[model samples]
Target: MINIKRLTTSDADFGARLDALLAFESAQDASVEQTVAAILADVKTRGDAALIEYTRRFDGLRATSMAELELSQNELQAALAGLPADQRQALEAAAERVRSYHERQTLESWQYVDDGADACGTLLGQKVTPLDRVGLYVPGGKASYPSSVLMNAIPARVAGVAELIMVVPTPAGEHNPLVLAAAALAGVDRVFTIGGAQAVAALAYGTQTVPQVDKIVGPGNAYVAAAKRRVFGVVGIDMVAGPSEILVICDGHTEPDWVAMDLFSQAEHDELAQSILICPDAVYIERVAASLEKLLPTMPRQQVIRAALENRGALIEVRDLDEACRIANRIAPEHLELSLADADAWVAKIRHAGAIFIGRYTSESLGDYCAGPNHVLPTSGSARFSSPLGVYDFQKRTSLIRVSPAGSRILGRIAATLAHGEGLPAHARSAEYRVDG
Candidate 1:
């Protein structure tokens, strides 16, 4: 029997216990930071030489030239062709759905001419444009996530990003066919076999061969995360994700096995990932615990699931569904599943969550793969302010302001007043020059 924490809202110390359970300090190792800083500086200084050296030292892949590491258009298509028919169909179908969904999120430029006397026919609005280039990082070796390729690349494509460069480390010159195939389908402009801090550095600061990207997006291991954190201001990055999280609110109507596996789905990611069940029915919670004991024995990643459950998982008994929602909003989990008869009705009660998986049949895994929303979600309580990655993330918006002669006089007077109050003489003079008042 696994040891999962049990809590009840009626307990006097429930709030404090919940706080202890929810705390996850993501502090990076000081040694890792120092090492990342050195690597970044080396890559910036040495260029292709640093890349070639690191690739050989880390991946044990001896490459004479940068050209040798790049995957050609032909190779990408061949990987796609080589896939089993079923795999190919699934990938393509998922890609299409992701593409279709993100198309709706594409932002367009808009302008409006203000006719107010202060405006003097000034045209003011915003211009939305696609990023020039973006770099995507995919983890390689034993872990193969073609789904990540589809999720990250498809959005940039939908947003009209000009060039998409992908970097995946091929250990000992061995590559994952699925990843390359997905890249091909997603229309990635370039592909390189590079990983670790070097890949991030090369993308942030251009080398002789690899081009600098406006933004770098995707997932990686600890070293890669450290590197991304180090080079944040130099280039754009998607969120530095925390462990996968899922908070399931069941109404005792959903199957016990389903609830258990739903918890397991997130827990199986790693030892730190959290899986929680908030239900009003105490008996149903016990049944779900029983389901966990029986079903955990069958899972291939049972050790990991067990560790995650024992360490961070929880089953909470609330007075009612309303109480469960209150706790959920406080936690602000990454994946919030409303496994209730009236899932639709409770949507209004939810104020914070990365992605709301409604109804019993809607698995969080579906949203991770083909459910069409970008699976890249805010984690570790970041859902309180952030959002899922989308086409809008790849598009840049510029404020448009055209001050007419009449508008300049009216606006400059106000600007000069504020600037003078702030003791900015230069600013005041700059605005006063245009102000007729």
Candidate 2:
């Protein structure tokens, strides 16, 4: 008896209805933005004192000093050792897979002579380098995702980030061993038990104890998102992601139960998360809906799943798989699953999507955990312009240019013309100097 929306391509208003379903606004409250601005200003001025005070006021941790909140290397190692053998092995295995996959994405510096473009042997290329340091924020409390630790930290490490600092909230001074273990395995250089806007400020501005990071990455609540938005130019950010999304295109060949569970996987994320199904078979869509109603009650997060499905979920009856692909291209979902038997054939049809899961057996959840790809993806139609978090996110590029003496004669004249056209006398003069020398 879920109240999910049902639609068909034959409907005249199908396009408009679909747009309404996919629309999302990530804007924050004015009050939240103002509060974040104050907190950032306070942290920028007071440094460690502001961090300590906020940690006490917000997290209820009345620590005497900042050192007390910092986790030592020994503590991280002990957390890894304390886990059950099976859990430790699984964590290690996932880390290895993630690390191995990101190794291939590591960019290297390269240069080449522009002999074709210029006869004077002018050199032009690019230099790739990783950020010197990066800060990672993990949401704490009842939810603890060690997977996020590996997803965010492993890429920074693989990109050769010199120091990786992690901040997680420890309300009442309680910590998650699994989180610490993942941090240890991912080679995080530091750990602090602080969160919210204050943690972001500490990483962004640096305190007496916490070192400044070149870029900050990870997920958090509204305040964290607000803080990252406020400090964007000061530091690099991964993305202010929206709700989790999954668009499944089934060919009516996949099992009904499997399709139902696939929708649940994303709906379970939260109430605003979206789960949509596009199929040519109207009866198969009904079968999946029935399966959803029947299997939903068994889930521990049943109420959350129900809310998400009833509010944002949809089942669209398309003319065929080609129509399904066209609709999916419009959605530009964060996670896309091609549940067709010949999933690979349709891959070329998909041009947008943060990550693509091929085949019925390849559930989006696999990409979330041990799938060897970074689970952090662009959300809320951002896949149209952005991409999944990878080693490239933590790395930067610099353009390389060198002009030979012979090259300056021709290059200088071209530069001088452009500079004069732009009305910049100094630029033209500088290029003229190179030509004369």
Candidate 3:
């Protein structure tokens, strides 16, 4: 049974409990660390030979050579042709929305001045160049999420990425048609039949077959995440994501059934996924709980949802909406749904959250698929500092400084002084040489 707490009687104590409940501590078991390290070391030492072995062991498939893993253009086209018209149309439409949103996020170079006639300036800008190559790891464990392909690949494409490579595992050495169709719709340059830690290793430190990528993106299971974390120094990664989390703030005006269903959306993702409700009214909580009982039986993924809620979900009655907003900011959830009366008014109070879903009509699922924002978000309380995967992730920025002779002379003394104060004569000498000469 899900626990319910009232904030009125023990305001401070209950608030602290809420904070403890929401905090995402590193709960990784020791075995995961050992396993990940072993896998990474194996890949580093054996290279392609190790990857082939791991692929067979984990994914139950064999790739004797790297060439067998790569997907051909005709194969991708056949996958798209095989999809029903409705599914194909939906994928294309979602890809367009994703493209449009990320296009707006593109940044350009700029130049700025520091002083007057003795002019010192810096080219203060970011070069929105795309990654030469990227790998998108789509999960093939319990189910297939074609939407993950679009969400991960389209941003890279809009950012002008040269090559988009996708890797997914197949149980019977056969890729799902839906996954292939999504790859086709999102303009993935290449597709590969590989997964788990070995796939991440192959992408980070290229094998004889899989090309080395500048960065890797998309969500995966624990082994996949651990592999990404282990290989982070070799290449860039979006985030070391945790399980899915949804924090919904609701009022008495909304229907109970809608609230329960909204919570269930994230809960079904995994057994550790969290679904929280922070509201002021007790009557609304009761109604939502009853509705959850009614709806849980109808869901095909009921077992997953039930375990998630029982383990990590909560319903807390706060003093008022102001307190609710404060708690929400502190939690910094991956997905925040404002199912309140004046959702817009509360937007200003949100200092943290990977993505905000405004109003009753807007669902978190929309953002996961057809919505204009990228779905690759920071999870496990990382919303406090990190951000969603975007066009900027594919690009790197380099700072340029241009100083005239006069500017150099004017700035050299300060540089020398600071360098000398820090007890570094070489640093001082380098600046002194420019002014002296």
lDDT of 2 at 201: 96
For 1-437, candidate 3 gives per-residue lDDT tens digits of 44433344246577577766666666776898788888878887788888778878877776787677778988999999988999888888988999899999876666576655544652233344567899899987556889888888888888788998888887668678888988888899888788888888888988777789989998777888888988898899888888899999987678888889999999998888899888889888888988988889999999999998887888878778888888888889999999988799999999999999999888899999999898889887889999898888887766657776777777888899999999999999999998897
lDDT score, candidate 2, position 320:
95
Best of the candidates, lDDT:
1
Name the 10 consecutive residues with the lowest summed lDDT in model 2.
113-122
Off by over 4 Å in 3: 1-12, 113-128
Task: In model 2, state the lDDT of residue 386.
Answer: 92
lDDT tens per residue, model 2, 1-437: 89999989999999999988887766689999999999999999999999999999998998979998999999999999999999999999999999999999999999998886565898888999999999999988766889999999999999999999999999988899999999999999899999999999999999999888989999998899999988898998999988899999999989999989999999998999999999999989999999999999899998999999988899999999999999998899999999998899999999999999999999999999998999999998889899899999999999999988999988999999999999999999999998888
Model 2 alpha-carbon miss at residue 299, Å: 1.1
- Scored by Cα lDDT, where does model 3 land? 0.83
Task: Pick the winner on lDDT between candidates 1 and 3.
Answer: 1
TM-score of each: 0.98, 0.98, 0.94
- Identify the superior model by lDDT, candidate 1 or candidate 2: 1
In candidate 1, position 118 carries an lDDT of 63
- Per-residue error for 260 in candidate 3, Å, reads 0.5
